[model samples]
Target: MEMGAENKVGTIKPEGEIYTCPTCGYTDGFHVSFSALKNNRKAEVFLICPNCHNRFRLGWHVDLSNT
Candidate 1:
């Protein structure tokens, strides 16, 4: 499907840091960032399984230190 400006960051941000199960297929949005979340400095990618209602978070480090 086509991606909009809000969904162009390559990550899905939900209201609360609640993610579904990755084992199940469920193409829906999930929460990644929360309050005082300093550990995750990079962008987290949430991918829902199409077959089962599963949610997976891909934590990436946006190393701007080199820049």
Candidate 2:
């Protein structure tokens, strides 16, 4: 699966906090992309800034197996 390719999800509210965009320094809205893997046990994430439309790789694995 592609990490930050055309595979993307959008307009979802982020869980913890909204972050600032490194590319444009905008801090209000964001889009999210999650690539599911390992039979839905794990996922890769992408955070996109709406202001600049810049995509940021959230280089960590989400362990959905916990829940």
Candidate 3:
């Protein structure tokens, strides 16, 4: 999968949380791209569901201390 420049606003190492795709009811994993804001207080997440091939966006809270 190719991610465009606009889609990649930031990179976070996969560590803190495991996300589930709501659209296709997928829990195993996701094709994830994300951008953090407010000094890592929040994040804008873009996810592609592997099972349904559907794209979705999410506003997530970043837990800086977790990692």
- CA lDDT, every model vs. true structure: 0.39, 0.64, 0.58
Per-residue lDDT for 1-67 in model 3, tens only?
4445555333334456656655556788777665565655556676667787565554455554555
* Top-lDDT candidate index: 2
RMSD of 1: 9.7
- State the lDDT of candidate 1 residue by residue for 3-36, as single tens digits: 2233333333444553444344343534333222
| Lowest lDDT block of 10, candidate 3 | 6-15
Ranking of models by TM-score = 2, 3, 1
Instruction: Supply candidate 3's per-residue lDDT for 22.
Output: 53
**Per-candidate TM-score against the hidden true structure:** 0.27, 0.53, 0.38
Candidate 2 residue spans exceeding 4 A from truth: 1-18, 38-40, 64-67
Question: Judged by lDDT against the true structure, how good is candidate 1?
Answer: 0.39
Model 3: lDDT of residue 51? 86
Candidate 2 structure, TM-score to reference: 0.53
How displaced is residue 56 in candidate 1, in Å? 0.4
Q: After superposition, how far is residue 9 of candidate 3 from its true place, in Å?
A: 17
Deviation in Å, model 2, residue 25 alpha carbon:
1.2
| Error at 51, model 2, angstroms | 1.2
